[model samples]
Target: MPRETPRSSRVGSRIQRVLGQVISADIRDSRLGLSTVTDVEVTKDLSAARVYISALGDREAAGQAVEVLNERAPYLRHRVAQAMSLRHTPSLRFMPDYSQADSDRIRSLLNSGPAGEADNKE
Candidate 1:
């Protein structure tokens, strides 16, 4: 049988959806361009949220994007609260999601073929 997700998880999912939309459409930070909200984890008490974000650009751009997001976190939180119908919206904490980068590296390793394959091809 499949395991059921907890109520907190459900609430966190909804909060993530609202936050993603609000941050993408409402938040205006030129420094942060073409950012994607990968995931959001809200605390059980709805006090804080870890917002995972991925950017489509170079390292410098990603760094700047994170800085901008951090600077505007308060505004983003307010926007989320406005968009969501929650009694206590969690505080937003922006974090660069490096899972995509890690996945890409793993894919590259797999695509490079087996280790010492050429050496073994005597």
Candidate 2:
């Protein structure tokens, strides 16, 4: 049998934890505001990681926030390297988290009622 690869959750979680600290204290990007690290997805070789963020502010600000993160990727990676004892630190890539929006959409759909139920009630 072939050896199974490790799930992203395990590696991603660790990266997220360290990144949260670095962003709050080390990074000096004023454009990023009231954000939470929702999750991270690390590649199998651990060469790169996608950091998912959920911001508690205007939707329009997300673009600028992402730009700031991408620009600071190198600094963030360096910070991670110093903090973590990994053989190789993966490059960081920021991505917006849409899970919250998906949840809201599902809630709205459910509130609309079953497909035929609304018609029957009418």
Candidate 3:
């Protein structure tokens, strides 16, 4: 059976949804590439939120996109506040999500077989 999600996580999910929509529809910065809000983590007291984002490009481009998002976080937060019905809108913090990249690397290694075995055959 699937475990129940925590209250903070539920709130985080809502925040993620609002943030993704706001970023895509409202924010207009060329530096910000095609970004997707991968996840959100909210504090227990709901004081702050850490938003994970992934960009469709190389590492440098993704970093640039994150910088743009961080620079425009206040405006995005305001937009999110307008959309959400929370007692207080959590402070937004943008972060690069590298989980996808890490997973891809692991998958490639697995497909390539064990490094020790390859070295032994040589």
Candidate 4:
């Protein structure tokens, strides 16, 4: 028999999907900008999950959106548990995903050249 996938992984995926839907459709907070569920990490015991989110905005706006999401985590968790029918609802922890920002910064640096060469050319 083949080894089965881990329960935590399955639950994490479900949570990510449900949370994304809920945030986009149900959340009415203005502070919550165009947010995307980047990733979710659930504990082995299925007791907690760290949800990474990215939003289309500046750093301050992203921070505000994350704060709003964290504030609404309990409601989101309940909705997710109901949707998945899980025995134990994992506590949701909202985290801002800065990978996109980092990548953008790296791309800008690469395109700008090592020093002033690109500026001089322009």
> Relative to the true structure, how large is the alpha-carbon lDDT of every model?
0.76, 0.78, 0.84, 0.86
User: Residue 59 error for model 2, in Å?
Assistant: 2.8
* Cα lDDT of model 2 by residue, 38-100, tens digit: 888888777788888876655555666777888988988998898777898888999887677
Tell me the deviation in Å of residue 115 in model 1: 4.3
Give candidate 1's error at residue 116 in angstroms. 2.6
Per-residue CA lDDT of candidate 1, range 5-104, in tens? 4855776687678767876887787878888788777776767887878877655566677788888888888877887788887888888887776777
Compare the candidates by lDDT and give the number of the best one: 4
User: Residue-wise lDDT of candidate 4 within 5-91, one digit each (tens)?
Assistant: 498888888889999999999999889988899989888878888899888866777788899999998899889988998788989
Better of 1 and 4 by TM-score: 4
lDDT value, candidate 2, whole model = 0.78
**Root-mean-square deviation of Cα positions for candidate 4 versus the true structure, in angstroms:** 4.1
Flag the better candidate by lDDT, 3 or 4.
4
In terms of lDDT, which candidate is stronger, 2 or 3?
3
- Which 10 residues in a row give candidate 1 its minimum summed lDDT? 1-10
* Best of the two (1, 4) by lDDT: 4
TM-score of each predicted structure versus truth: 0.77, 0.74, 0.81, 0.88
Tens digits of per-residue lDDT, candidate 3, 1-122, equal 12324977898898899888888888888888888999888888778888998887666667888899999988988988888889888898888988777787788889999779978987
Residue 6, model 2: lDDT of 77
- Model 1: residue 95 alpha-carbon error in angstroms: 1.3
